[model samples]
Target: MNALMAPFGGWNMPIQYAGIIAEHNWCRTKAALFDICHMGEFIFQGDFESGGLEDVFTFSVKSIPLGRSRYGFLLNEQGGIIDDLIVFRIAGDKVMIVVNAATAPKDFAVIRGRLRGGLFTDITAATGKLDLQGPLSRDVMVKLFGEAVAAIPYFKFITMNILGVEAIISRTGYTGELGYEIFIPAEKVCELWDLLLSDERVKPAGLGARDVLRLEVGYSLYGSDIDEETTPLEAGLEGFVNFDKTFVGKEALLRVKEQGVTRQKVAFEVAGRRSPRHHYDICSAEEIVGNVTSGVFSPVLGRGIGIGFVRPELSAIGTPLTINHERVSMEAVVCDLPFFKDGSVRA
Candidate 1:
């Protein structure tokens, strides 16, 4: 392979050009860059109802205001998530759906199969994504893309000219900070990367750093924290689901709600340096309860943090627990999510 490759989601991807921790620290103090070309972007060019796009997700696509985006999931008949996505309503008949990289092909096929009418196209290869994230993201974007970039509100986006080409800049990101996700032409992505790096405050970051950033803020990793076997209600993600709309998994979710969840997602923190990891057994005393879905060593909190599933009764603050691996065990407690409370996510 011509490009650097490392393991991710059973695929080899680039780890870094410089280093992971170097990139991580840069994002915290200054601007850290990211190349997200592996993400999937799809365009649906038809009215929400006519195209059957409105019912595709748990929320109404047509109700989303113009130039704004909403995050939610596509569910199967059993109420399990097909994928988590952000939908940007660019125009009346034009919507941009951003999907995760690992589920790109399956998401496209499933979404297309559900649509009754419309011009649907998977623009993954033709589109390129980059994230310039930090407290200084606005300033950097404003400096390059002009005032239009500076005016975008949180969760809102604008399609404008960048580098003389049409591009979309949204004030949305995985990190709990002021950031922008720029969608530009595939060919111009490298150019934008070079231009953004010209600023002293901007430095390139990799997916490794991105993962840490997102996790630090309690943001759920799609495949890890959720899957086809879990419902939004059980995941503590009911805020993203619309009860007013009829969508796939609504019935299943209602049923799950009535039945009460057997298990729910919970966030916990270690009292010391040892970190929890995926599949690490969670236990109250010696009996295994659940497994850690996602975990990381948090730089901001100076402790290890993670999210996992456990019995609802056991999910409580100050509950003492232990994370167990084969020959490793760590003392942990069930603390609140977002161990790092100070963030510019909504700023």
Candidate 2:
């Protein structure tokens, strides 16, 4: 069990088992197994309206059909997001909430404080998550679980028996690749892990490769690209925030909408291989505008790509810019997200 370590969201986690590039390529071409056991999960069984669960998240939970999940933020009273999470509508009144690893405790406290009744349990320890991702993910699931998994649409999940145990297979994944997040009892997780790895197509990948993959596809990392200080409007994620329904932060967001946002999240590409990193200043015609929040070397693009906060006017596509750090400077240009468009995420 040789594992290299790296820092992630205040936790020292495995970067890769074999190597980053090899694991990444394996996931792209064949199949890859990822140990996502660090993520947090909760079970909430109660009336959506009466338990105050409906008013908790930025999105409506009742609207999510059974076997489906919705992604959104949980905001504090100040319109600041406490954490971003996904709610799986497992049944009529039973929902499972998946949250970030680091923010699990905070999210639990916030939700519990808001709830009046029903059973809410933090099942993080009892839950172990493994992701199987690749162009051939569907083939693997279909062969292993049956056609039910194959027919499941994107963002939908199906609870079925795997290895003689109940498990949930969700079509949603963080990596911009065809993948499934398999949630099973913690005791049985290692069994599934070994089962998936027994196939010649699957390899083990860690958080490092997953980050680069997600960022390359222009997906926002929870704490990096967005936080309590930034609203969905400013973060370019208003699509997840339903304006037609009401939530805790609706008034603040609506007020901000009326006035317009000052700083907006923008994706950019460096002119060369020199990657712009976090806190690197972004300049336009030598005038400072914003700074990079997340940046990485895109293997597919063979160049540097990043996302940053900049003046709304300067956050347009093809805007010429320069990224400057302490002793490193690089030429960059604003570009649309999903720098790599040919992902096999859903193929």
Candidate 3:
């Protein structure tokens, strides 16, 4: 397990084991194990209504049923996305909020400031998260954990005994695969990792392969594709925002909805194998209209796939664009997302 380690979100993380492309391909065909213990986990226990938890996010937390999870955004007063996170309803009065590693501190502060009565506590130091993702992930998990793991539907979870401790196994993932995200005590994480890797069907994947896998499925990266300066409306993620709910950023989003966003997120494919890098200029008719946020050479499509923000008029499908950076240039065209669509996510 001699992995190339690098700094990510203030933690030393594995960037690759064998290679990025090799791990990416292994995940597409078999099972891939990801050590995601760096992510932040918060526990909130109290009344959903009076505790002020329901109005903190873009979606209604109280509406989430027991054993279910919801994905939404935490927004600032300006309608800008603070972070994209998932809320898991563990019980009637308890929920676990999972957030990106780098933004965890600020997110905790922001959420705490908004709450009036809920008992909120940061559990990241005591918790560990591992994602088992890929087409064969379900089979691998069921064999190791038991048949109960097979019954958990997408966005649902169950609390069970594992490694002599209570663990939560959620049927959720970032890779758009039929996978599971297991939350266990930090002390037992290493043992669980070793146990999972003992199976020949599972291979360790690093952040590099995770990045490529997420991009192929059109998932936005927190720091890159979406950030504090970019509102969910401009990022083409307004669907996650519930207008019916009274949230912190509702007014700003309403204003944006009325005035319309000048720039919008667009998915594009390069004409060849030349990958579009972040910060590359996105041009239309030789005019720089926007910039690339995230880009990668997609092995599935055998082309360059990118997510960028451009003038609304230039975001339509099939619209011609040119990505340029210094001396490098590549022809591209706006295309639908999920450049690779054969994922076994819902299977």
Candidate 4:
């Protein structure tokens, strides 16, 4: 139960419990329970268009079927990302928006400013979220929740009663593993956490391990890999943007697409155990091309791996690069996404 604590998104949170590497390995092989209550959740009720909700994000809100969720972005006028979020069609006239912990306040302000109608409420304080992730997560969830838990597919969700309260059990997660994110009333979350941990297959993981897991799968960290200065196109996430839809940043994005993005996000694998740290210089032939955004000594790969933004011409797979910071330098190679490819995310 002893854990290393650190400050994150204005909350004192656990950085690690048993250990970061151990927890990361456990999440890859078995179920790892993460206390993710710090994430922000918002509820919107009203007409999707009349409330100005349909035009708020890069993806189409009205097109999402009920009981399903869609991942996309909110952007500024210059097409810079405001926040990357997931929208859930919880009911006919109601939807839930889940966003990053640190960007919650700003995201709320930006979203509310754009909305001319609708009842918008921040439900983060009242909601508690826990991520149960790993290859065996499906089996563990089915045993505790019900047979229905096993039936939920990727990116889908269903409301179920747990601990005498209605909860949303979504088959979605950040780790590249078969997982579920459970949202329940704040008061009952601890009870459910305790009950889940009582099972032998589940262990506690923390933000430190979570970071490594997400990065290994090539998922961007909002503040690190992508931020207000970056657009989805530049981040290689054009698939999440629907240009046919009218959005706040559509014009700027179109312009960027026409002119071409100056820099692009790239994933690389280090040749050794030396970890690449944030802000480390990425170079080719002794010239700096970009900087590392997120890096770690990957337990699964047994080597250093990192994500960074580089000139578009330098992002090709198999390109040789050097990651340098002060006296530290290491060899790296531009590689295809998902530095770790054996995950059971879709299996």
Please give, for residues 1-347, the per-residue lDDT of candidate 3 as tens digits: 99999999999999999899999998999999999999999999999899999999999999999999999999999999999999999989999999999999999999999999979999999999999999898888888889999988999999999989999999999897889999999999999999899889999999999999999999999999999999999998988999998999899999999999989999999999999989999998889999999999998889999999999999999999999999999999999988889998888
| Model 4 TM-score, 2 decimals | 0.99
User: Clash pairs of candidate 3?
Assistant: none
Provide the global lDDT of candidate 1 against the true structure.
Answer: 0.88
Cα lDDT tens digits, model 1, 65-184, are 999999999999888998999999999789999999889899999999999999999999899899999888888888887898877899999989888899999989988888999999
lDDT scores of the candidates, listed in order: 0.88, 0.88, 0.95, 0.95
Superposed on all Cα atoms, the candidates' RMSDs to the truth, in angstroms, are 1.8, 1.4, 0.6, 0.6
Q: Give the per-residue lDDT digits (tens) of candidate 2, residues 200-296.
A: 7777898878888888899888788888888988889888888787688889988889999999999999888987888899988888899899999
Off by over 4 Å in 2: 7-12
Which pairs clash in the backbone of model 2?
177-345, 178-345
State every prediction's TM-score relative to the real structure: 0.96, 0.97, 0.99, 0.99
The model with the greater lDDT, 2 or 4, is 4
State which candidate, 3 or 4, has the greater lDDT.
4
